[model samples]
Target: MDRPLRLIYCVFGLVTFCQASIIPCKDDDTKCLVSTANDIYPKIMSGDASIGAEILDPVWIDEIDGSVTILKYKFERCTVAGYKKCNITSLRIDAHNSKLKLNLMCPEVNLSGFYDINGRLIILPVQGNGNFSIDAYSYNINIDATYKIVKTDDRKEYITIKNFNFDANAEKGAKFQFDNLFNGRKDLADSVLKFANENSKEVLQEFQRPILSITYKIFIKNIYKFLKAMPMDNIFKQIYPKLHSFTCVRASLTPPTPCKADDTNCMMTIGKSVYKQVLTGDKSIGAERLEPMKFDEIDGGLTMLKFKMTDTTISGYEKCDMKDLKHDNAKMSFAMKITCPHLEVVGTYDMDGRLIVLPVQGKGKFSIIMDSYDLSLTVTYKIVKDDGGKEHLSIKTYQAEAEPIKGVKYEFQNLFNGKQDLANSVHKFANENWKEVTLQFQGPIIAATFKKLIKNTNKFLKAMPMDKVFL
Candidate 1:
């Protein structure tokens, strides 16, 4: 749906919520713009989805001289979904005819966005009946009306009605649909992957940077201009960027337990709001020593990261949910064991800084060092999807020596061992299978999409937080 951006313009301040938003109604009831409650009772019992009803009209007594003028009366269901994942893919060997079940849920889901501070923001994850209530795919949506423009006189305050949750069942449903159709044919891999894209979209964990950086850069660049014009700090105040959901938690290859079904080494899960501390560094400094995930997958969760090439290697397991983005960000224990001293992490990453974000879009930028100087990589994210699904972040690094003052040439041991390095293999594959590696996004689209993805990450970053996100 191509919709224009319309906003409820006003100053930001504490506004009391009115009673018009608290009335309960069926999912299919409608038609309450006017008329008495008894007059609308017949329509309410008729099971109509179009007839509107005013939920706030009962207690909403506003006389024109000594009354309330309600403006911008609106309603919507709010939802919230988690926005973090791992850099690995579940390498599950499905049993023949096995029915796979993934009833995952987003941190937030299906909720309201446009709302009134006066009305009640009733939220329902999914429309259902009772204790055994299951979501009725075919149901109606009802809302109370009183803050309409016809009643507006002076109040401009408003509340937001929104829902942003990751629907795990919906996501798993998509995967299952395809699993049922697959007959174990390699030729069908494309279709399966395509389906994954159509349903789950980008698999990378840092799909918010591009949007954040662009927006942040724009803000910094224009803040002086705005400050030159306006004086109030509130004028410059914007929605602060927040680190939402993170579910990339993967299991450890070797933890305190056997790591099987009974393993108790999983990450300790957080219930509600969690305050996690993280450290910040640059390409010059990296984790000199790192190990695999400290616990099991069931413990809590892993931070989903699609690192390009960092100078440092944090030990952890690679989750399977992050296998789609073309540029493999996997930190396989084997790979880390091999390229320990050769890589570099360059660029900027969110080490935890509060930022003002826009309502619809924002971005964040991050850079990391491998361990020593040399390996440098930048992770970026934005508020929109422009990059197809791949990143051109790979930079070829060759061990070079510094110039000697005299005739002596300093020599250092080559960290790389094999002539046929994985870097070379990856390059070869890209050159040959560029179509598959890059997919439909081409080069331009790739930049457009990811420019916003990685930026919105790291808001809730933790220090050396559970490294096992390799997929």
Candidate 2:
């Protein structure tokens, strides 16, 4: 009797363990289904992916009259949407009457059948095809689906659609069928085809129900295969790398320590080596300064940096045509030349105790020699990072003062024949044109040049693995 009692207790424990393991398997299946549905349904609705069917053999046959009717139907290029032009709100397991809208084209449905005469059913084999289209407002569908877990022959579990049903309706004008059967009376055949087409709603309703069921079954099988192929634990590890402890390095301090405790007061020095590496590596900005960079720590997590470039030649090419200046009445046609031989910048930026967001404002002075008369300019600009992790620079204000310099001249052989007054007039006109042209080109050129700068800086900061760089 004691042996029998022990056997029964062991059996109960085994049953409980099996049931507990099955619970998690069920939960995982549910999660996989929901994730796949959320990812795939939108693509099908947007026409990015298509669902369709094709049948080649004859579908219907009549034995009494010796008549054979072959019907071929397909739903081609269908785009699904929500009811009343709204977006699909939700999709869930065991959901019923989920409304959907489909815009589809039914192209060239072929039919072959026998026609009846006044007294007898003639064996006049008719073959014809017609195209039909469904408008967005006219076609509407309601769907019901439920899923179940099944064990395969290999004892592996899978999720599959157990039941699926749908009903659809379309406007009368959306129905079309062809009848090129009668020997001589084409109009009568057309009338018959139209009549058949009018009642086609019922046929379509029956055909679509099974197609949806098959589609959902395929979807469920694919999702299960995908989940089994790659586990979720590996995916999460790939996205989020291991976080390591990092600290700021200061030359004045005894040694570097972790910044996790007091990140707000930590100051990571941007030494000359880092500055030279970043500036020299970026070919787009083409910045080379002989003097060492000056960095000052300021209040409110801000840093001030002063950069100077002497005897530097900045050259850029722009395709200039007469048509670009559409609003200008002068219609002056000459090559546009832009250059800056010397430039200086003083900027202040706040990192907000984080490496992600960098906001910078600066004032710059540059000398521009456009074709001839030397012009000195001062401008204020701001560099901002957008939500999509792209950096852009915009000029807020600009001041340009042009003056004629001795021995500095421009030669437009055809327009100005070396006349001093005429040359001066052209230079004056060019200076005025510079204002508008500068406004148009400055934003794009600066943005492109600074893109490499911003990217390299962000990479360097993040590479430090420090929580905060105070200045």
Candidate 3:
């Protein structure tokens, strides 16, 4: 079939296939919008792998970190359930103005994760890391978004959300439970839990921003995927002849040549090319801009040190050099090392307790200039045959390590809460002990920094064949 005919057939087939759940609606048809949402919510949340829409309910979140006036918290490996139970209480769609709003309510919702917390909570010190559970009754969520129609170079049109806001509230408040608080001290843990439950409403209000921010990300991502597959113009109407499925777009890199199995130097050169593309982000290849990498929050700690770093930005990656590359073809693994002469990290930090017996308590802006920083990464992948019978590399997992070879300089503003002399003394002392401080906390920082690196690498590799990338 020709392109036009195939598209027509697809539209006809889709209408026939989804007629029970979906139908054409006018731009201002509020009843149609709500009815259609209720009908197709289950299918959408169940996910359609063909369109690259991953499962939305029981959503998996890798990490979430945020801070309020006095409390900082981090959650990892979180699973949020109950969105599937939500009902669209109200909805607004103004296609003429490129705006959308949705109001959802769920009778009950639950979240479980590993959490790390620091700072003060209602006149009590809150610090710990362990399993956590939060249950909210009669949860409500409101989403508002405005998007622009973007026409891609391929002449395909998609909706790019310009502004998004997500708000969450609970009718019956929430309950919080955290295990292993204060190193599993039953007495203190009981007291803290009791107090938290009593003040759950206020506490939830304070932490709602970060939590809802992540939920917003999840919803927006799915919306983007759905809109991309079914363009904005075709979303509410029966005509979808131009609908296109989502797929990874590969970067335009130097042509590949077959390399000998033991040619490590050639591998290093190819690795450099991949890194450049991944680091710089090529829109042509669907890579997001990463020149000045940014992270909203990162939290981790040692025995005595608990810290939160927020609004962090790191630059100077373009000047990095690939030091070494090694491959184990039989084992399907690769290890590489890179060194950068300088990297500047700027962020605000909230820290408490001591590091190596040095008092370190602060909440303010911080700057760290790392000299001769080396990063090493080990990646293991498996080759899988796609539906088309072409082999692609699927990254199983990756490990990253960073070390500052020469030294590091640190400057923090507002230490000791703006005591000039005390802040200066602490800064001097910290600069002298930079290595120890970094050693205690750099593990998580480095991991957070390289998360995008690994993700982009995998993305780049996923769009190509193993032979194309390595051989």
Candidate 4:
């Protein structure tokens, strides 16, 4: 036989025996099903074969007269004829065969004497210890099978095989104990071997149904075990990538509305009520505004969203202040202290944002961040999708500025502690030159603060799906 055929036979034989050791379904069993399917599918597609298991055991074949017990039946190889397809509904195995190396311990069976030339009578006793080989054939095997999710007695759901049945003809070829029993009688030995071969089909047919049934049970049990182990959510995601999108659309359309004549791109609308819940309830985009998120538009694979936000009280960064900052110039060298307790920015801004689906680019911003100085900010940001399909925000460009506000305190400490007059003079000068001071420090400080904010925002966006923001 060719190398590929040899390998196929070897794998088949091993898997046949190994199938007996399948365990019951467990909580995390889907991996085994997926792995087994993956392993089998490629080999089947490539016209190669691999063993799912290997085992050592004795097999017994019972007959009407007596039972033949194989002392050590070594499954040598198994090979199936080329098949086109296999699925949950049915499986077809063309004319397939397997080989076995058998060591038989056959007891002596008494036979009536036969007269030779009407002169001498000879009695025969069948017994033997010799190397034996057997070949099993399964012809035109067809199986009708179905897949189902069944709940076990323990209330756990498991994928299972259902309505399993098969049709096939089984035939066998065996090198019986002819050489040992009928030695020196070539004619008798030949006759005995022929009879065994011809009648072997009957014996094979007798056991074929039970064997196939057991094999199917073993395979099905393994599949059940695998499905039981895997989580349902993961299984759904693997089977249906757009399942979440379908769910989102369904949830949005509880009370369905009519689509407009020109609204071919509109998936669903987020009305005022749902928009409020989505913005306020979401921890990532804690948007607060009187206006609602209007109709979402999709153009050439890009999702555009328009929204307005105003007077948002976002918590977490309650206080940000800088103390003991020394500034040295040609006229003065003194430590400056500036603090803004409960720092926050309240502003009104509108967004015209577009989310590119294919390349996953996000553009446009309303007000990204604010401070107590009523200074609003807008940034160019991108939505990055990781390898695992999770999205995060990254700030590309930010506009930073600082405008002097009255009542803002500035404390200056002179180089010499006793120079109280100099310290007062320095403080007065700093207040008088507030615009220059603010311009000097505003870029670096805002840049640093925005960097930290972007990092935190990215993490928050990653934790929550971007679709939730639109919903």
Candidate 5:
């Protein structure tokens, strides 16, 4: 009886010790991350019931709609296989920024589903309603994700994804098969499928975005379940530690390049470095994070043309190029010309009145992309003495001017009470007349953006002495 009781106790302890099978990875340990992922990939692919993880080998998607130039297609009740056999080729974890990237490659991925297709696939007319299958050979996927840690009411920590992006590629291309084409006429179906398979690369490229969009959704859902069940510390042996103010005060500061009061070139170089650091939320020098900059709301447009945007998130500012920099020691001021490849603004909007010539009214989600976004900024500052008699730069005035060089793209969902045709027409008109749209809209937008920049710069400068920045 004593021996049996001891044996039972040992079994219980073993089960408790094996609660998490994944080997933990230290912060930013790429090798460990890859090894751990590889070790657990099979279990995750097969669905780990303990973690409530779903089987990913046959990832399911209810529906997907996509268009390429003139080609439009839809797939329903899709199931994709071969994920179970995928290998993690690379893994990069930037735990400091809560960002992770991993590469997955498989010999082949098979997709089977019901399809309704209409449109020109290259020169061939593709119109069909039946079953379909695609064999993508040498399939590869690159995934990038941003995540945040959430604490439950019971004080348990979990990782939740904030943003996710991915793209798919197949080196050996793909083969497509569509059944019951042209009312079960086999000849026409064979010809189209043959042509598509011959030019598989191009055909697959056309549908990649839509296909991957579904892939991202399903992939995130499963990964989220796995991550939620595993605590942050369990997945990562260590989380990147934040720098405290006391430590930062004693740390050595190195300029990107040597800088002087009137050196515009050096200033530009340093400005670029500082901008990047601030964007990443470097607390070492008291710089505030600007990535995914959020605004509760911004009100603008003509008095009659009242436009309000809420829960706004601005991104793509990191792609900015400092075209020109000017520093004036006499006035303690600086002027800069910064151009970004694009600036993306996403938010919910409430608008009433005329946008240029068209009368527009809506309250819905909006996404605007400003291409070749040129911004000019002029900042004037004055030296202020702190309690310790240390001098710091205080912003006196901030000014900004902006222009969209290439043009702007607008997507407003649920616009005009879900008037699809009307909203699409409005989008076309706005895109065509983007200059007028920018002219009417850029002022308040640029002002609000620069306002945040000024606030962040002041915060950093307040922590830094005037001599430190100039010298």
Candidate 6:
């Protein structure tokens, strides 16, 4: 019996001894991040496939207030065929029990179009409150226009609006009034002009602006719908593999440029907004800095507005400091910096949902060197297989090895469970067995605290619903 216990202990002890022989290789910060990210990618992707399939991802009409709902969308990375890359990251809605369930797995691309890759769709659980603007715009536009669109929809050849068609009138005075206004009397024109001059602002205000009300009857094509209507030939052939620059405000547009390999011109995205192809100047590998502005408060806190480049992810907002574009063909100047924030809750394929983004390193690198080895317990977590058919997220406990780094022969301690026995296996191995793994970094630490990079990354992932594991 002692032999058996000795043998079992020997097996465990010898393994621990082997672990003590770790010889590390030095690597830079990028390598450190890539290694860590690659190490976790499989788990993240698997979770996306399994857990994301279970959540809800749609919004329905019956859930609206007074048969209507209004929404306001701030624009971000778009410049492709006049579309902005935006993901609906949050919904501030006001209604009675108004819940907008956005399918996070929805096939959407950066203001360009959607593909099946990002996930089936994202379904969101909306909380808090604000009136939706979709209904309000619809209401305002439907009323108060002499040329209000009767059939603004495209199924017909022309936009039929409520026109003031003088041609349709048979009244004798109407024709005389037209002749007087157009050809006959300068005095009559001056009198009418004076009346308009007095009331013009009010008329324009009524036509230009109305009560921002919500209406149910109007159905205008939204940006997403408009993009979806592009012929597949157009989307895949003309749009894909090309890059564009867009301004989130006004009529800023950058035409698509051909994409090349080897440069940062590789596939990159702004938030959930996708764009491809970029011109690499004489230098082929530097990513253009993206300078999209970011807000400190709000869900889905980042926006992207630059075109694609080689190895960098940049965000941009129009330079408040620069002069405006002078002409149509002029190359608009933009200022870019590293940007785009991950969203918390609220899901839709807007700029915030774009997958390939530049990563942030917080303080970049930090360190934690121990003169003695002590395995920490309590604050540990491990990837676990749960009953939801998806992986179970479980707590792991670590016990310090209990020996000083200098004096005694060192040993390794593990925090793992038998049932949730993954032990970082899938990340380290194809099979379920864990491997003798090692890591190297540009320095011993990353970000301000040695643990901060990982901590911030985890915070980003954790803020997202379990279904939305990073893509």
How big is the positional error of residue 316 in model 3, measured in Å on the Cα after superposition? 1.5
Q: Which ranking of candidates, highest lDDT first? A: 3, 5, 4, 2, 6, 1
What is the C-alpha lDDT profile of model 2 across 105-203, one tens digit per residue?
222222232233222112223333232232222444445544444556766553333554555454343343333445446876675555545656654
Candidate 4 lDDT for residue 289: 27
TM-scores for every predicted model: 0.15, 0.27, 0.47, 0.26, 0.45, 0.15
Best by TM-score: 3
Error of 1 at 125 (Å): 30
TM-score, structure 4 vs. true? 0.26
Off by over 4 Å in 6: 1-92, 95-182, 205-219, 222-224, 227-471
Tens digits of lDDT, candidate 5, 1-471: 122222211111111121323344455466876776676566555443323344466665657888668888888767787888889888776645666677999999998878998889888987889998999999888988776667888776665678888888888999888887777778888888889999998888877788888776766666675555444333323322221111011112553444555566666777776666656655765655788788998877432257888999999998888888877654445678988998899999998775654667789889998888888776655667899998776765554557689989988787789888878888888999998677666556666777777777777767776555544
lDDT of all predictions: 0.20, 0.30, 0.68, 0.32, 0.68, 0.20
Q: Give the C-alpha lDDT of model 5.
A: 0.68
Off by over 4 Å in 4: 1-130, 136-138, 144-148, 152-156, 162-167, 170-189, 206-218, 229-233, 237-471
Against the true structure, candidate 3 reaches a TM-score of 0.47
- What is the per-residue lDDT of model 3 for residues 71-125, given as tens digits with 9 covering 90 to 100? 8889876778888998988767665566677788999888887899988876778
Candidate 5 colliding pairs: none
- Give the higher-lDDT candidate: 1 or 4: 4
Which of the two, 5 or 6, has more lDDT? 5
Q: Which of the two, 1 or 5, has more TM-score?
A: 5
Model 3's number of clashes is: 0
lDDT of predicted model 6: 0.20
Clashes of each: 148, 0, 0, 9, 0, 74
Per-residue lDDT of candidate 1, residues 1-471 (tens digit): 000001011000111001111123222222221111323222222211111111110111111121113211222121111211111111111123221111112232221122222211121011111111011111111221111111123433222212111222233222212221223354553554454345432221111122223222322222222122222222222333332222232121132221222111221121011101111212222211112211111110101111121122223111101111112222100000111232222222221111111011111322211222111122221122125542211111111111111121111111123234532543344344433322211122122112221221222221113322211
